[model samples]
Target: MESGMFEDEFQNDGSFLHDEFEDGENFEDTENETSDATDDPKRQGWLVQIRNLNGEVTERRMWAKQVPKLPVTEQIIVPFKGNQPVGTDIDGLLGQYLGRLASNHKLLPISFKKWPEVVKTYKDWVWEKHIKWEPIHEAAARTSFMMDMGKKWRENRIRLFHTKFDQTLSREENIRNPPLSIPPTEWAAFIDYRLEEDTTKKSKQNAANRAKLTINHTGGSKKLKRRSEEIMSQIGKPVSRGTLYIETHKRRDGSYINEEARQVCEKIAEIESQGTVPVEVAIDDSLGQVKGAEHYGRVRAI
Candidate 1:
């Protein structure tokens, strides 16, 4: 049931990473980044807020050393501070591991509804392999591991479609370079699906929708949520989304990364000057000029 539903989502939305040919700048670029925070969490210190007995509030410094850590293959990670993992991508660290687990377990056509099953399989496999993990830190269930797996599954499928499997090439030629995790049988079916007329049309439509995006992030794979939290820790107050957006899109030289960013930041500044306008409202006003979408303000799901 879930597989069929999610299969429709794929057909209607294509890879959801980007346009058919590349991991579009929309999501694949925003969400796919490697974390280099594997060193001593002490270096990051703890970005924390302290409330005193006098009802006064002050920010403080801390680290992953203060919180629990998850053993994710090679690096130790603190999983989204016990919240829904969004905006950030751990594909660099966990993508291949997820791919292998799903392939080995015959858990192809991954779906959100089946994430619990996948997590169960992961736990069982970890136990069998005797991989040590804190009982509380279940990477499969707690972090964005499953989501990254889903993205990797779709991204690699499209990559294979574009790069290795040539339309002019014979079936044997195309299937010869099947992805490491994909079986030959699955590869042949994938090729057939991509060649189907309905599939081609849907992919084109989805790509068109993605291309309509007016804003592109320059935050580069850094998780803005964590970065915002760090800023709050330093400034001792909440950072508005508008401020964060403008800050992230600017270069060290105080120049906007692109014209669109400059325009959006300008619009935000205008909105702020008028009175108090929500960040999303400011973004909608700016984005609506180019892209006709209404209320499409949430960029970073983090």
Candidate 2:
């Protein structure tokens, strides 16, 4: 369900605003600008395409005045408009502007197709103001700001699609349609079965490593020979350096019984009870000089 759409279209790095407007004719660093365009009607507005809270986008012409009091929230996106002063108020402006885009569809939660009904409802809402003025003001300001700039009201509807929106949609779809139900007892049994299977797999791997152990008695050193003899006496077999002898008194389930490990431990305890401590035998030095059957690629006549 992971969609690469937003990541493909919009760069998630903080430099999105910069990259988005880099190719535009009016691109400028809105962050460093000092002059306030908040009240300036002569300022040019930008026809920005932004994604809103409800995952829908439509083109809106925005000026610095429209987003002056916009709130800083995750639901909105603001494109870099050169004439607009983003300053420290970018977050809020972005949020309000996004909310405005979503407002026409979801804010009031009522549909009125007739123009008179829309006007009457708007007038009634003007008195109540439950649907905060910020979104309304932003919408009105964007329209007025665009008109003041002498730009045509083009129906050039543009949708701003980000990858994150797809994921959000997927999550909502999941909430609407969850996975099929499993009875509590069967679910618990399934979990226990999985745990047991994992434990058995690990135990088998450990058993395979233990099976690789072999007794070696090839070293010529006296100390190694003595130690090797001690281990051989205890295990009734030869012992050598790197030889593995993994014995355990208890099974993996923790039940204890006299096992190979317990017998080995008893023998070692008996050896230690005598003065000489058992040590590992070293490998034969001649083994290092032994050549393999395979030869190098070429040989010289010398």
Candidate 3:
């Protein structure tokens, strides 16, 4: 009798009772299986998130149709934005171009300390965009892409600044004098005075050395000691070099005071003329005597 009852319960081609015990179990398993299939990363599409300047975050679910197919391996080529292609030698013209952008683009410092961070940030952005770039090609791709982006950004920013703010971009001619009360023209003289002071110290030491050598220690000569005192008295007196410097300063308004120093000043002036001056600002946003950025902008009209 028990065998017959077990056979009836297990029959495959017969009627079955539908209740929570059986139906609920099957339904739960099927729902979980569907959830797992949908959650499978391989089968899922991409999602993109963008945060705007106003701090609003927007998300987009990208479907397959929305994405472009990856090009075949053989079809891949170095991306050329202008005449130059990605991964090409950048040590020449491209480097110079980036350097100019660094100089002219106020937003881009293009400094040794900051460039690596910029590159890394760009790489992360590309990754977020689902651009599957290889590790070997990442640097070239990032550099080329950044160059194109920076060039455009700088140009657009300049245009915007001019159009909206009624201000042109700052140039080398705008370089201000050093914040010291002394004029830049007088710096050459000041530096001369300091340099003469330096030479006098050396002269003092030389005088001491000479006095020691000339002293007749065995005879204990009083005249020789007086001579030593006379030599020491001349220690602070300007040397021939200082006199020559003074003459040159008078000749050309100190333009020829220190040839090397003058050359450096000229080189600095040249760079400033091109608006490539390296400026330092306190984190408090002071630019020399300019109190704040707003005041600085008013002064610079940048």
Candidate 4:
């Protein structure tokens, strides 16, 4: 029966259900009370005032967890010293108050007693280790004076120092006196120098012109013949006399005729001297005469 009773107790889920119910209620209560609970600390009356030995009321705040305990008489003395008031039996009350002030003002929390020694050590170290090497106003002035003196010495040395070759006595003895009023002989020498230059320039120009003539007469002739052959080949037939003349004259070296061309040209010249009308004009004149022979004869010089 006890075993059965234990099994029944294990199966019972009421306690678990009750816990869940309680948790839901507690969550609701927490949600409703959260804002009030959060504001309670800030709204607390932490700041207070107490009378000092001088009968002046001094204000203090009890915000921090660790309150400074001091004797009432000593606390009174602190207010006289312009320190924060504290409760009796507080140790380091003044320091703690000063620490809060320093924290609030973003100042380093330095003990008044140690400040003088720290400053003294800092000044001594700076002077001995670093300041001595630094250029101060007085040192800079002295250095500038030395520099000026060095510059002046260098200038003087440059002006004074001279080798035997540079000595004025040697130079004066060797000086060629400025040509005693530039004699007429010197004018003749100047003319000779200018003549020599002009002769050299003229010779150079003549040599260049000769070289250009040789290139044009020799190399240019071959190039011109090749170009004329190309033009004739492109025309694909014997060119008319007038057309051939124009094309040959346009070439660089075609001004001079080959032997064959010279013979042909002589024959043409002989034919031209015969006083015959050219075929072009003869044909046109024949046609005109047929149309009106009397009018054509009057127009013609014949």
Per-residue lDDT of candidate 2, residues 37-84 (tens digit): 233566444444444444454555554334333332211243222323
Clashing pairs in 3: 171-275, 172-272, 172-275
Candidate 2: worst 10 consecutive residues by lDDT? 152-161
Q: State the lDDT of candidate 4 residue by residue for 203-288, as single tens digits.
A: 47877888764212212212232333344568775333323333443334555435544444445445544545252334333223
RMSD of 1: 12.9
lDDT of 1 by residue, 122-187 (tens): 545433342233343344333455565555556555654676667787877886877664567767
What TM value does model 1 have? Answer: 0.52
Name the 10 consecutive residues with the lowest summed lDDT in model 3: 1-10
Q: Each prediction's Cα lDDT score?
A: 0.45, 0.31, 0.30, 0.29
Whose lDDT is higher: candidate 3's or candidate 4's? Answer: 3
Better of 2 and 4 by lDDT: 2
So what's the TM-score on candidate 3? Answer: 0.20
Per-model TM-score versus the true fold: 0.52, 0.15, 0.20, 0.13
Q: What CA RMSD would candidate 3 show?
A: 35.1
What is every candidate's alpha-carbon RMSD to the true fold? Answer: 12.9, 30.6, 35.1, 52.8
